[model samples]
Target chain A: MSVVDLSKQVALGIDIGGTNTKFGLVNHRGQILAKGSIPTDQYNTPEEFIDALYKEIQPLIDEHGVEKMIEGIGVGAPNANYYRGTIEQAPNLPWKGVIQFADLMTEKFGQPCKMTNDANAAALGEMMYGAARGMKDFIMITLGTGVGSGIVSGGNLIYGHDGFAGELGHTIVKPGGRKHWSTGSEGSLEAYASATGIAITAKKMRAEFPDSMLNQFPEEAINSKTVHECALKEDPVAIEVFRYTGQKLGEALANFVMFSSPEAILLFGGVIKAGDFILKPAKLHMERNLLPIFRNKVRLVFSELDEADAAILGASALVWEK
Target chain B: MSVVDLSKQVALGIDIGGTNTKFGLVNHRGQILAKGSIPTDQYNTPEEFIDALYKEIQPLIDEHGVEKMIEGIGVGAPNANYYRGTIEQAPNLPWKGVIQFADLMTEKFGQPCKMTNDANAAALGEMMYGAARGMKDFIMITLGTGVGSGIVSGGNLIYGHDGFAGELGHTIVKPGGRKHWSTGSEGSLEAYASATGIAITAKKMRAEFPDSMLNQFPEEAINSKTVHECALKEDPVAIEVFRYTGQKLGEALANFVMFSSPEAILLFGGVIKAGDFILKPAKLHMERNLLPIFRNKVRLVFSELDEADAAILGASALVWEK
Candidate 1:
């Protein structure tokens, strides 16, 4: 077989967050050659944001010149719609109301651009380059500030009727259990399974166990990472916090298994750093709750991609998706 | 276009139940031309049941003779797998182990046969001939002795990797709230939203309200139908029973909506006969629980097919599906 030069062909991936907008040039094999970021808060409008992006991204394009083939652009952001290519009323965005993000990017860069919510982009990336490779039916869950999910069924992401499916985070797992800090929803998966939720659990648990290592840190300074550090040293309070959180997460995962019967459930982002402490209880509870036919059939594992670069890689994978 | 005779074309539909096995010959317009049933209780094995079916159905085919074309066979049964075309160990059925029902049907009748769980077939029937007509993304829920569901996404039934997906009835809605008498699983949707659950609710509530009409009936005789009659007579106790059951159902529906974002959710089977008494509360609670974007978007309605014929109709629809 003739060798093909992969370095010459690249896709531009952009990840837009509440504070920062990061862009990267990625090849087909999930390699990021060049990357940069700009504060998303500086722009007053989406149009201005697109112009600023063009100004920064154009230089990177010129640096490669005619030697590289810039295939297209793929973007991942909050509240983005794949069908309409717009971001509608995202709570944390600088722009208000509906912004035609994909249209603006395509026009500014003179290339086709596709957009989807960040969780979905991460799922696509996993399908192409990460833990979910060669698997057609699975769930990609991000355990960050909020729990986010992308459900793939029969090798395709389920977009549903209005292209807003797979909001697993908001599904009530506890039923009037814990109120979400922002959405004000009661007993959602995000209210218990997220890093923010873990921190909340740590604060509550450490206060009750005064002699625990978790209590050594100041109240305001305690977080998931600090709890993980405490658990590493065999702190019972920190360990119990993860056990309870994992129990909730596992129960929710069982519900999802019953709904879609996926081949696997992949966990990603910060919460997974606790390792076996979280995974053991999660796997045990999930198996216990499922029907006998479903038990021992689903594989539960953590993501293999680096969390920092996964967003860009996933967005770029969307460019190569049919 | 030239008009064609519909009477000349027909498909065979079979619904296998615990006590009785029903079959029908249906035309393209969803009309039943011939129907019959055999006692499934008498058969010792799946092969014996297939032989009994052949003996009963051969006479109907002979009656049509050269005038009609029998296209294929479709079957709906409990614990059936679409991918494997087999019925796994269903507790209600007389068969002891896995039954290769489709293969047996194909061998005996010399026709291509497809099979799925009863609920999935109902969803297909709805899509072809009932309330879910013209809908690509929707969910079909049957509130019978037990709750059952069939999820449709992107114009296809989600059989998932294992073909054991869409077991919505078993999903835990109330977590440690109620115990399923048969499965022993606590807090499942079927534990509170089914006809069996309604009967249990009526028994518990009427015991407290001594003057209620529901107390007039014997506890063993009190079913969903009795509760409906008493509720029709403006009995507050009966009404409260449905309100509680509907509240549990509505919360479960909200969880489903968040997971799939379907265009509509169609309710079928006995419990829906309560009409607005159940519908009003289910609608209210569902909308109240949904996020802002999902609120007021999903249409919740009852199935349009006749209860007696829906099973056969849905089974026949599978023959026409691609």
Candidate 2:
């Protein structure tokens, strides 16, 4: 209600990816007022990365005349820990071992900092500004290179005891079936439902149907996008691939529904671009597998967040949580 | 803090079972000062049952001189809904349709009343007075005639969107494996880890090993208790049966851990009396099935509540929750 309060309401959100790190000055309305990026893989040490980020972001703060307005900083990174404010053993990150990310950000920016894994950030983003807004209970699932999930119950994101809960991707859906590439776990949801899994399914289907349209492209050329294009053309092999992936994803979602009874499950990321080609089977199978009490009750929807700004918005929302 | 406050601190807990409905006057310290039960099946209708219950309990209240001390009442019954405060179509209870159990109790006793399914009440009880005291997150499992579960996260019971969350028992552990008599779903945890499941396992093992000690008892006589006793006596057939059951339970628990990542999981009910016989294998398999980050981090323990008083105490704890 005061001018002083309005002047000091912005937050800085940073999303660190394997290649690039995106940063933005975000307002309480989930709007990104200013934004920039730095190459994440270039820095050999986290200290160097933080120094570069501050150098690039400092001018933006001054230009906006809102240096004092930034209340805190929130970061979303691979393998980040909310409890410890550290990123540990991220396979794709440039840094190795554990990095005290939040403490370093706080020291450099002179503000409080909080951090969590990117998927959890996305869930918070949805809860704050996306399709899940105003909803207290839901599951946010990202289907990228590998499957990832963020669980929200009773209007709060579950950080678990160790801050590494909500690993729905790693939950075994098929039992002794396909093996995960990194964890070596068999039948994980990641093994069957991720974009990588979709590509693998396309390859398998191509091999099974020798005369299929997929045969026109070499095996290496096949990806989720290519498969989607082919499926849109009514390619049987590509259509079957999506069907199989949706079936596995739907069954797993049904089990998740039983576990938490979320009001809705939101799908995000690249693979979801296939839309009803994948969603129809996913919803059908999810309902098919659910118990009678849960059938037809849970809504399955797509994320409404603008993909370009979702990460920054999600990370920035964490600052408000403090 | 004051004598009047202390006198009015007590609550009445009621646990309604198929055969017997138990009642107790309890304090905040989880102490049961006075308790009794009435046969649930003797009354033709809920109205008659409520009248009989009040008649039996009013005398105790007068004798304790705490008639005015009881602050509120809480009831735990099968199919009870926490949100709607009703019990619906309980298979074992004499009531066939949706009953306004909470409203009736409030009207009869002239006090506020709350209700939840028996398992959810047990979870609340544990959070207030049992193994889960001081814990913000945990899963409570009761392995009775069938498997039942209650989930707590952020120090609150997860009622989900429909007041029917935490149905881990029905989550499919083995897809299309064993048939659930009630839900008709196959390979549910209830079909593999429940008391009935143990008896089925015993009978199957007896059929396989004709010379086993289990064969000495008629196939109809074999039950969870009998299997535990046989395993204690070093009967290989019974021991194998427990190992198989534990393997299934542990695997299912691992999936649950990935879903919520609770601080600990507490096991209760008649089947858990086997203690190490069941726990050791369950823990081993659960740990074996978990992702490396989660392995050895979650505590698997038995419920510490006295079985005779646990249900009543759990229900009574609900009054304080309001």
Candidate 3:
């Protein structure tokens, strides 16, 4: 639209996972110009990982003819702190202790860098380019290996005193109902609403109904994806499992609505692929549990970002925010 | 202080309740120069109520030499909407339907006016003058006839889409456990943690322990105050009631901390007067339920504002905020 708008400025986005780290060069409009990945497990230390990552991404910047146009870098990583720019005691990361992630990236690339937990990055991405565009208040719930949430209030992500807010998955949904593996707390939302929780539900259901079709799969093989597939085919036990999961998720969501009063809640990650099989019960239970003022007011929808590029896009949004 | 700071500015603070309405002229330093109350049931219509309120407060303004010094008016009432400046279908208020409360105040006072639900007003008061001063992210829980909450995140109160966010009392704590009187939702925080809930616990404990000291009191006479009195006298059933109440409250608070990661949670109103009787168990259970990252970080403290002046102070804070 203008000379400044059309300028060739870009930013690097890196998403660090336990197994692999994906990096990309992205423009202001959330377009990924070039992207690559490196296996994270190969590095013995964070320094080696950073070295390999920089080597792999340097060519992508040159190939895009934006080596000089590079602005900053933004990273989305587990247990990353926006205020401290460190990842502390993240269980999944290879590093044993605290890692000064953003500082390392800044030093390596000679550019400003920011980092936050992955869920918070997803929230920024949704605000900038996806379902939550033009919205100031919303919650992003990632129902993946473990349930995670990012809360946006007054157009800012809520990083509490410790830079570790928005831990909705750990909120107790059922008092003394189920045990959370990590926190050892009972009836946590993660214990009932996460993908792992769904698989656990399948296992419990199979034991309850010995003749159910869910029994055909080995105990360890019954994951959320398989449960979704079975539910799609009208397997009674699988359908019940999703229904139970939605009920728990919906109830917890109602409580979240009462807390921050977000305009909408965007559901992301693997389990949401079940769609209406999960959404239908979630909506029903959420409405049923909501106080009259919040009933029918909050929109519950799935994340619209492409799964493959969402983390990269989300990280890029952080750079643009700066 | 600057010349402008000493300029004798004041705000009219009004706290509207079901039985009585308290009004006061408060200065920027949270000092009440003049205050009074009127029976709320005297007027059948909202216009009549407004007329009476204005007539009563006009003389107080003149008595305090604050006619020209009055900056604005702020009101704390049930079901008040910050965005629309209206009170919608408040069950406790005498009015039958939606009332354009803030607009009416502005018209009558000839000054700026603002309104929010009573709990949110309390949150503003805390931020300005009470325990939450200098703190941006915190939760204020008012433990009274019903459990009310005001959530402050990123230095702003979260008023969700319909202006009815932060209804923590109605958030389900124990699914299928206790039915809330208002929403009929089972096991809401209000069902167990409010003053009324404490009385119900007393009644239930009396029934369970026929020989207990609580059985000496009539069912209708058992209330939070009486229960506290009994606990002070070492009544086992009453002590157990408070313990159970605190356990439920603490667990719910743990969930809240995980959601927003507030710096502190300020407890206000009648039940908090029980002090350590409630706080100890609440703190214990809350810490027990919190994830390790959040454990022992959140301060659970009683409100510092004088009970008689808190509502007025809270309401007045809204004017200063403008």
Candidate 4:
């Protein structure tokens, strides 16, 4: 083996989402050695959660012969802060307070660790391994429970003056409208465009048209995939739902385009699984809404990165970026 | 005068808006020697406009004995490009094609000259002489016939990969619903919030209520000023107009904050002249739309810089920055 190859150490990459905590052993080459996920119990304390993760990962470390070659651990989670290295009361997580998650991982593995918000981690992943691999400027959007965005301009992640920039989801698309959420007051695109939000919108439409084909599925059973399937079958309700969602997304993106003027916005997560169902209208509305200067210039694209592998890759990539 | 003071050369700064072009001669000390204006003729070609500007400005340059002390000229016009040093098909300008405007000024004066988009120049002015003095991160918004924006982040103007990253006015606030004259789409905040847009909306509302007090004025005379007067009197139509415009402005700003997270957003121009009429409602709605992390952290403020003097200071400061 070459000396250059021996010098590179493997990293432990962890992604703690609302439903699962996924992790992998990865090297600088973007190669994964071992990867798996564990259910994230809402009631578990942070300490308990870390212990559970350690139990699952320790065996992988031994299997891969990576004990001494491991350099650090990198983590991505909702409300995680890169600068502070802590998770600050994530809404989805049941934890009530800030948690120094990286430090806990470090304590368990006796290795240095770093962490950042999941959205930012995804951007780092793109920069290191995916569509944005060679590009210096772009924006990444994750359309899951809530819309999350990460901006990369001039090859660096933009943390802003307070390290709190890149809040694209909350950018208003409708100035005065209802969002069907507890936030009360309308106007936010996040109200109707996120995965849960889109599902809610479909549910409400089905209520208004009780006899529509959409009523065949219970509200809880509705998801972006099912919505896309129904729309592909020429279901009018599903088509309308996707069109409306796309319209909102397009408007919000028009605002984003004006701000960053990024090369493209990479879309990922559940809602985007509908693919062109959401993209077609979004492109149409966005093009119509954009200034002539931006006409057909900014691209809306689906992430080329693997969603199943993205979390671990992004988390591992964070260590590489550092 | 001290030797240092005598040796310092001045720069002529001019900001050309749709209504007027404000001029100033500023020395290296950031002091203005003379300030004045001339009405902009919408029918004039780019060359004819330059001739008119020279006629109006020559006497002021002679009056201040500024000819010998002036080192260069700096101009801010709609759609000006700092990189190309030209104004190409500006929306408000009557000109139909690219005008080598900087070259025209340089050929006339035999001095190095610089130019940028009006909004960008105003942003630089704010950084050099106004509320954002010594501050590196802020956004300057011009609320006029159309909403225009200039952004400064990390001590540098955000020119983007192209010199067009800060077009905050074109951001979409309503999804698939309203057409903006600039972009020909429904969604841009500029469609419902610019002074012209506000007037358009008022006209539509007036048609709905023929006997309303707003109809007493000529259609051409409808403006934000008139809207403010009526709103102050609790006129229902005018109140709704301000509320609607303010909400859209606030929502648009929420997107900007997401991308920039600047220290503040500085408001200026004719519409903002209504001050609290536009500011109060915009502030409330902005807070409502901002993410929890940014809530109440960023500020909304009016420009503290003198409008006329600011242009020249900004122009002169460009030389200083170089």
Candidate 5:
């Protein structure tokens, strides 16, 4: 009989981004043993992307050993389907149509693989290792370039019938409000609550206050980070940007709370770095909008995962969670 | 061992409404053996209500025998909680604070009892025997006096942390648009989508079109049923009322679709009887608001369960579903 080394077992986690793709070999404790990155946009075809991924990850696989990967590989990508193991028409990816992502990974690596959208993976990561450690029901909102959400009900991620549930970003928060730059959907949560949305809010609001601190920087320089820096200095226009974004986010959150009645809502990504500047307004509006039964019950907090490492960690959690 | 009489095995289902309380003796096959109703508002205290229920049910119990009731009792009320088996702060009920409802029923009947809010009970009824049969994921919306919702995710009704999830009616569709009569909250779905809301809309819209048929009726006679009748006669103002209500409902539904992505959303209650006048506009607006991935996917249909029987059937289902 052979004895197993539990500590050596690891899963390969891959996060496919529009610009960069990151991969890491992680243990069950969420510690990354080895990690690497490859530019995602360089590949023109799904085949080319898979080939590049295989060549890059082979060394890590050899070092980690197939026998040690009891949990196998997990991938998180845009438009990914957990039930189908495919990426269908990902707006950001170079691939134009449905790509059998998990099938290709399994065929190349000879290990079982699972896939889910980035938001759902983040939710699993939070539930397993981060702020929502003991919660059975909670919502994870990722406020990056665009808003994304993962809903957990009855302790399980809501995949819906098509494995494409939890699209709260696209939910219309403002009817006939701001139009999205990409999807052209008006008043979507993503149009106002995201990092891109904050930049837009900053630019628009600064125009009204020509002498505001935000106008000191070039138009291109006014992003979420710049706005945060200005807010720290008590800049009035900069403060308004966060308040506007928080109101939209908080109202949408109130609707989500009524839908699933989660215990908490965990905010992630760059916009959340504004901290209480954004958090306080969101908390206030969320309370004001909620029914008395739901008011003062749902906790709104920031995620605990390291942003630079969250994607890879989140993807890896899919293997263990599944 | 003695052979069990399968045909006689039954459950006692009780549905407590604000005006009256209805109950039935039902078998496993969804057949009601006997039923009755009693005024609910006359009771001054919860204890008096329970005593009245016991007195009314005792005759039926004597006839059926305890051995025949294998499934025990299940109660559905305004603010019932399944976990704690209590009714808490029911706004429409005579009781105030928390009442140990199911515990009292169990003590009175010498059998286990379960309890849940009426809408959730209706959802269980739909899942077990009506529109949502064979479906694991669907949402139930009752559009009558108020817009009540019951969310079924992965085949189970979502009873949130405090046993109060799925309050879609309370979700605000038009911020600062309309004030709800009872809740005092502005722009709630119930303020626009319910029968009461439709009557309010009819009264407001009819003033602009004095020549419309709706103006012929007294303000007290302006309601969902009267508007439907007027629409059937090609009344323009009446038709506009449904269009406005449907628009709000559909928009709210689009938000819900993105949240849980249910396979279907079942509409019940008297308001749904308006048929295509409401359904067509609702379908159009719902599709118009949804993201590309979600458009034309979810089935929005009226529930198959008879409205009069739905509450009792839903309550009875708790016995079997448990």
Candidate 6:
């Protein structure tokens, strides 16, 4: 039997985040013909989310006269499993237990659809169209509310035996310090590198650097974004926070590099918007902590892809590659 | 050109360790037809070692009347690189520079030959004959004086971008504590997991348990074997040492499982002789530290093959698989 010409067809890629669910129609070339996002709260149930998604996305495919050009749908949800085709208990997402979100999409729209965890999807996206495009072995780290990571080796995502291999965020940069959700231990790398963790660190440091410009913001109001903004203004405390956060991230990455020496480590997320604040310190600390042989060989690069578009492109590319 | 038949062909496998170098002729079924080990001396030059190896091995091949029956030769050495077909600056070996060890054999006997790091050879061995015989994505860790590891993914060894992907032993467990050379950090898992490292930990903990039965043995004379013997006697100090060693190893493996997620982690070496004393605690701690999703999934199994012959079979299997 002749296999269908999937390589020429397009796919719908969706990224469901806490605030918004982004959607796009993408072709095999990693090009997004159209894209948009709808507030996640607009849909209370899984059925409502699918309906709202179709309403927002149908027009894009129709506008481009590519409705017939579409072959499948691919989704990147918070806790999705590519193997199971379900999102299981994503803390940030309102869903509970296993949600056969893929079945719902196919039942309603009649298309072949695939899904993977958000971090893995992002990694696939980066490999398909972003900083790591054309690269086979690399890691994508999203320094967001909490640390989430995706690993690609030999052009394949390392989903382990159970499909949850890339948990780079909670690798215990600090053995037993701060309590983090991923690992029960305290002071994990995620506890320090993530947005919420950074905010907590900023609040604690606020007392030490009260005379510094970081004191201008209240403890409750501080976030990774504010810290980045203040660091850019040369606020000593803010700069120190980014430096410390990067140091922890870098050290943890060094350990990871030893396990699988990828060509590069691509960093993304709102926290990374601090640019050099996090990148410079992270590189320094990582070099200091890395094995001598791997010190200069590995590149710690940044992702250039836009977050919303990246997810869609990645999800679409998943189907394209298959 | 007609391809050579391999059904009856055998391969000669040699494992060069610090103390003894083992040699064997193994058939395609991973059965050893002949085998022996010769003491490796620090004072001997590379040329002398090869000469001695040939003297002992030639008779075995001749006695078995297998000169034409042998297909190739494969060597697994302390710091061998398959791509380079040479040993480059192995830590335990006195060799200072690059040595074309495989070429030396091929030149002497005019047989096809290949070489790889010992741990990688073991992985290929497992893939060909032992516990991971059919496994594609798994890691093999050898816990001797120091820890060494090899990775197999997608039915082939992951050479990584640089032929060094499976350095699991070196993946840091303690980021800022006393680092062993292997893991490139202070307080690395290797610092406590390797036989030498475990001995060190046992020696240090000996002070804390001075009143314990283990105190009857002199601290200077304590070693991993003595500690194991003591643990057999239910010595609390020895048990505690293994417990700490298992805990640290388990936590370190938790980090590794997050990266590779192989079907099983195959453990080998003298330290493993303690069996359940080491494995039971290690598994318990590993399960505890593992991501809730990966609690009891990744198996930490031991190699069932005889330790003395496993390396020879593993090395021979390398050529057999190719």
Chain B TM per candidate, please? 0.96, 0.97, 0.97, 0.88, 0.97, 0.93
Candidate 3: stretches off by over 4 Å: A1-3, B1-7
> What DockQ was computed for model 6?
0.59
What tens-digit string does per-residue lDDT give for candidate 5 at A162-239?
Answer: 899999999988889999998888899999999999999999999999989999999899999999999999998899
- In candidate 4, what are the lDDT values of residues A1-322, reduced to their tens digit? 6464643478899998888989999888788889999887654788888888888899999988768888788898888877678888788887868888778778877888888788888988888988887876688889988888888876777776676678777666665675637456466667878987888889888788776678888767887877887898888898999999998788677767777677888888878888888899998877776778877888788887889988899999888774
Each candidate's TM vs. the true structure?
0.96, 0.97, 0.98, 0.85, 0.98, 0.93
Candidate 4 lDDT, B89-112, residue by residue in tens: 887667768889899887776777
The best-first sequence of candidates by DockQ reads 1, 5, 3, 2, 6, 4
TM-score, chain B, predicted structure 2: 0.97
DockQ pick, better of 1 and 3: 1
Q: What is the lDDT of residue B25 in candidate 4?
A: 79
lDDT of 1 by residue, B98-187 (tens): 988899999999999999999999999999999999998999999999898999998889988889999999999987778889888889
Residue pair clashes in candidate 2: none
lDDT of 3 by residue, B114-223 (tens): 99999999999999999999998899999999999999987888887668889999998999888877778899999999998998888988899887788888878999
The TM-score, computed over Cα atoms with residue i paired to residue i, of candidate 4 is: 0.85
Task: After superposing candidate 5 on the true structure, give the runs of residues whose Cα lies further than 4 Å from its correct spot.
Answer: A1-5, B1-7
lDDT of 5 by residue, B197-297 (tens): 99999999999888999988998999999999999999988999999999999999999999888999999999999999999999998998898888889
lDDT (0 to 1) per candidate? 0.90, 0.90, 0.90, 0.80, 0.90, 0.81
lDDT of 1 at A70: 87
DockQ of 4: 0.51
Candidate RMSDs in order: 2.2, 1.8, 1.7, 4.3, 1.5, 2.8
Give DockQ for candidates 1 onward, in order: 0.81, 0.76, 0.79, 0.51, 0.80, 0.59
lDDT of 2: 0.90
As for lDDT, the candidate ahead, 2 or 4, is 2
Higher-scoring candidate on TM-score, 3 or 4: 3
